[model samples]
Target: MSKHLLREISENIVKGDSIRTKQLVEQALEEFTPEVVIKEGLIPGMETVSARFQSCEFCLVDVVVAADAMQKGVQILKEKCRKEKAFAPKGRVVIGTVEGDIHDLGKNIVAVTLEGAGYEVVDLGVDVSPTQFVKAIAKFQPDLVCISALLTVTMLRMEDVIEAIKEAGLREQVKIIVGGAPVTQSFADKIGADAYVEYGTNVVYKADELLKKKGRRVALIQLPSILKEKHQEIFRKLFDFTPTFLDQNNRVILQGEELPECCRECREWNYEHNAEKTVVYSCPGGLSIIEARIEGDSIKLGKIICGPFLVETPGKVCVCAPGAKKVSSLELEKIAIFTQMIAEQIQIESREKLLQVQLEDQREILIRALKFQEELKNALNEARYRSLQSQVNPHFLFNSLNSLARLAMLEEAEKTEKFAYALSRILRYILRNIKSTVRIAEEIEIIRDYLFIQQVRFTDRLSVHLRIDEHIYDGLMPCMVLQPLVENAVVHGLEPLEREGMLEVSGERKGELVFFEIKDNGVGMSSDKLREISQLKISRSGRGHTTGLGLFNVHQRLQHYFGSNSGLEIQSQQNKGTSVKVFFPYIPQ
Candidate 1:
């Protein structure tokens, strides 16, 4: 049993079978410790996959599938492992996509990489504002801050991020790194970022490096390599010393005192180049080294101490003023290559995840569809069975009232009384079973009586025309169709128009087909908006939420009774008129 269980775990991992991985993990629960499975089997497997991923021997898809396989087992093991093992958080990092950009792929990739590298990563998601980042920083006090963006428009958000950090008074303590398609070293430097990484993998590396380099004063290296001989002499004359000094790492460090005046032009240029750029000191409360690129030149000046005059801060620092050179095509190409590689790896990882998600979703949909079909079949069978067993559903009662009205009218006991009695009964029935289907003839009579009542309600402000064919008298239709259609034309359509409008209702039967048409010459819908009406699925309710379900409900009921091919057809032209035609196959007794 032990050997078989071990083989099961190994086989699932070697095959990169996520489903099997889940099965193995479940089976292992009876005997093996969750910690043993996680630490010995899953974690080691993931480590190998990550290595294969880095070596390019295994594409990101393979690695991700392997990761998912591991995650499946790890998830089951995690809760148990928490109880069984002492787990320590490997430093926290807060990450977000900057404001105005909604892209999350880059940020998600970085987060996954950071977690894989054993750091606890808190993802703040996308479109995060400066204040939000600052608040997060203050709350988390993370070892590092990571910001990402994809669009050029939102790239300016990095400056906002910098300002937010400064405002929180934790700017010095937190090391900041920026990356994305549009982010560059110049942008990072301008925004006062501690570092800028080109890719997600590099993000992990940068975070680690920044953590190691924390508390150590980094020398600002000047670009002494690009200064022309003549410019170097002029610089020497102005400063009475060499403008470049190589600190420990060949980074140019400049004298803190000599840099203030020379840096004024570049500060103005910073403002000129970037709207968000301001001449903020290198450090908020302490003198610190800075590298400033001379504007519109191919020279970069190395490090200089920037602070209050005569505040002597002792430190081994080098200032080298490099030539102010436009970033060459070669350098831009390198950055692009690295970003694209990272994006590709991320894309592969995302695809694997998407595929798994799609498979799961498809399984759920299939199950749901099968269940719905069964319910629909049972509903249809029940409906037919009920139809056979039932006698008359108030429709017969309505006709009996009409007959009673005729008899009363013959006796001459005031015609209005008989009409009112019939009206009250019809209204009561319609209110009772708003969802039930009635015979076509009965529905037509209801419409006729409704129109008669509305003529009295609106008092000559409205008019109605109704016609019916004898052949459809026995066909089934939902109650309240004609009344609501007419009501719609009057209340929403014709009432809004000042002109006297014509409302027409006609019905006919051609062979086995029953057709009902309602036309109104009032305010009509435009082509664009009218097209949207068909797609609208509204709920039928008397008062709650304005269900907008009147005509739509009638249409759905028609289709429900007479198959999908037979339903409502509506047409309208703006400010002219609207027409609705209902077609259904008449099934005779």
Candidate 2:
């Protein structure tokens, strides 16, 4: 029983049960040296469990439970190992479920197996967002970025995270391994992911392959075998570096280190002095080189050699030097294609970043619009606020005018018929303009009738004039926009003062927006009043006869038609006249 318990404790440590592992290790230590227990019982037990798990002899839970037991046993020996700290991690890896995915069983299993293999595993929990993955990459700067996604929908999001890395130009820095139920080797290829493993157990081999390639590439580049231990400044510069090459007859003849003859030819006419080895390389197009060689080690081609040559046949390697190792031209082409793929990946990542920013901006704008809309809805719900059409008190205007006409008839007033004619025209425009939208000309005509009626009512006290630019009458506007402003002008500007007042109405098209202005030289509003009225959320308050709904309601209607920027602007003082300028986006017919 004790031997079995000790064996179980060792398995748990290998499986990453840091919690239960210590307990079992301590229990095992009561009977043996912490070191002896770890060697004879713990290590061997974990090896057995790992084989069983990998070979399908043990199920996932079986492995996990055994790992938990093993962790407890390792803890008992940890104090002794600390004094003598001898074991080295097999490898280190950082793993996570990709952005927008929550499934993690596969990832967890892989983490366990990697731990069992003596690797230090950083298992980031599920549903990791792209930003989180990027931050983790930046933080740990791990040997690999292992991403898992269960759903096809979520798997695609991993492409975005990869793009983020590419944009930062970190694609070549860390290897990327992807896996999930929906993921395939093709998907991995399509996204430029380094490797794709289908099963958790398979990840062990995949990691080994990836790490080996990484090491070989580093060795080929003649850099440090352990890339992770390089100086931070070197890594920073390395990440930013890109390599370009020259090819001969569809063969990669020269890596970036050597200058191609084509480049020297282009520079032959120029006046730059330099002494360096010359070689051949492909430029932007088929083959023409520009620019002097930059100072640095050409990562692939060891030393700087300069010259140009052509390949005799396909699949032939361009010999930079007779004895140097030759690289397959096809392989070089794949590398070049990979560079372009990296650039495109970067562009995609930038777009996603921009999209995220736009969404945030739109959300803020929508929130403000909703607040303004709520305020307008509340103002429109008032009991006394009548529709603009009904607010003019048409019955009162007609009855008063009729009584005056009867008296004028008895007295034979000179313009009695003309006065009645103007009133009829005004009422016709008001009753007929029902559609929410109408041509600018139709709206202006409505204003014309309203002004004519105002002139008749206060012929001597009010002087109304309209001067609309011909270009302004070609667009469309909300129906009745002009009439209400005219009403407000006559009622508030002219009626409030005994002196004669002048009201001018005009409009013009400015780019994609239509601008309307109503100028009144009547008792202008106080600064406080103007400020309150200019605010979109202020309630409309005035006497029953002077219900403050006219200007307020017009403001709301303009906003409803064209958005918040469509509201009125009052330029006024207590005595000076007020000028209300309204702007609406012109929807061209």
Backbone-clash count (model 1): 35
Q: What are the TM-scores, per candidate, against the unseen true structure?
A: 0.31, 0.31
- Provide the clash count, candidate 2: 28
Runs off by more than 4 Å, candidate 1: 1-419, 537-549
Q: Mind giving the per-residue lDDT tens digits that candidate 1 earns over 232-343?
A: 3443453332333334344543332344445443432211111121122332222223222221111222222222211122441213222221222343233234323332
* Per-residue accuracy of model 2 over 1-589 as CA lDDT, tens digit each: 8778766665565566667667666676677655456556655765687688789877544555565565444434434434443468656788998754555556766665566555677778776766566656655657788889865545776788788666544566688999987799998999989999876656778888888777555434322221121222331253332233322122332343344444544533322222233223542222312222211122221221222222224444433323322234453343334334433333344345446644664565445445644655777776346666474777567667667767777787757755665565555555565447778887787677667766777878888778888876667777766676667777876788878899988888766667889999988888787756644224433222232336555654565566423546668878778788887777765
The alpha-carbon deviation from the true structure for residue 487 of candidate 2, after best TM-score superposition, in angstroms, is 2.1
lDDT of each: 0.60, 0.59
Query: For candidate 1, what is the TM-score?
Result: 0.31
RMSD of each: 23.0, 28.2
Estimate candidate 2's alpha-carbon lDDT, on a 0 to 1 scale: 0.59
Model 1 Cα shift for residue 502 (angstroms): 1.7
